[model samples]
Target: MSDPIYEQVRGNPKFAQLVKRRGRLALLLSAIVLVSYYAFMMVVAFAPQILAVPLTEGGSLTVGAPIGAAIIIISWLLTGVYSHFANGPFEQLNNGIVRETLK
Candidate 1:
């Protein structure tokens, strides 16, 4: 017998449809992530507020600005999140499904 998830994926119309939709959506999300990284550069370049802060002992470089280091941290988080899919289980699942479909 096949793996239950695979079996369900093969047999259930809703499951199949969900996979089809989500599979394509994953690709789109991945692409969006790739584009977002580049866009962040533009955003950083345009906004001088990202790293503008009082040069004090206790002040960070991103304080007292509209663009906080928190957003940069979030950008890194988003990059890491996207990279997880780029080089993680979702990629494996996508490859496996494609290989299975091709067979």
Candidate 2:
């Protein structure tokens, strides 16, 4: 049997807005991750020397170490950013829309 509540929410403008906004954000984050990951891979494959260079004249750490760490950190930070926005305003909007739809 078809559900009226589902139908109502499906037809609601807020539902559409929520879907579009969340989809755009997801796509943006995914693109960023894919680009960064592939760029790193390309550099590793085509320019290993670049990542092998020393960070400083006397330092033991290779440039790749820090850059790799930064990539990991950035990924974590991006996830946190998405989580924050999703749990905050996005969740609130979702709840409001669902409540309105039920009413």
Give per-model CA RMSD. Answer: 8.4, 1.1
lDDT of 1 by residue, 1-103 (tens): 6777667457645446546765675677667665755565675688646546456777664543434444556667766766776577566666666666556
What TM-score do all the candidates reach, one by one?
Answer: 0.39, 0.93
lDDT of 2 by residue, 36-97 (tens): 88899899999999999998898889999988888888888889989998999789889989
TM-score for candidate 1: 0.39
Error of 1 at 53 (Å): 10
Q: In model 1, which range of ten residues has the least summed lDDT? A: 61-70
lDDT of 2: 0.89
Query: In angstroms, how far off is 73's CA in candidate 2?
Result: 0.6
Model 2: how far residue 100 lies from native, Å: 0.8
Q: Please, what is the whole-model Cα lDDT of each candidate in the order they appear?
A: 0.60, 0.89
Candidate 2 backbone collisions, by pair: none
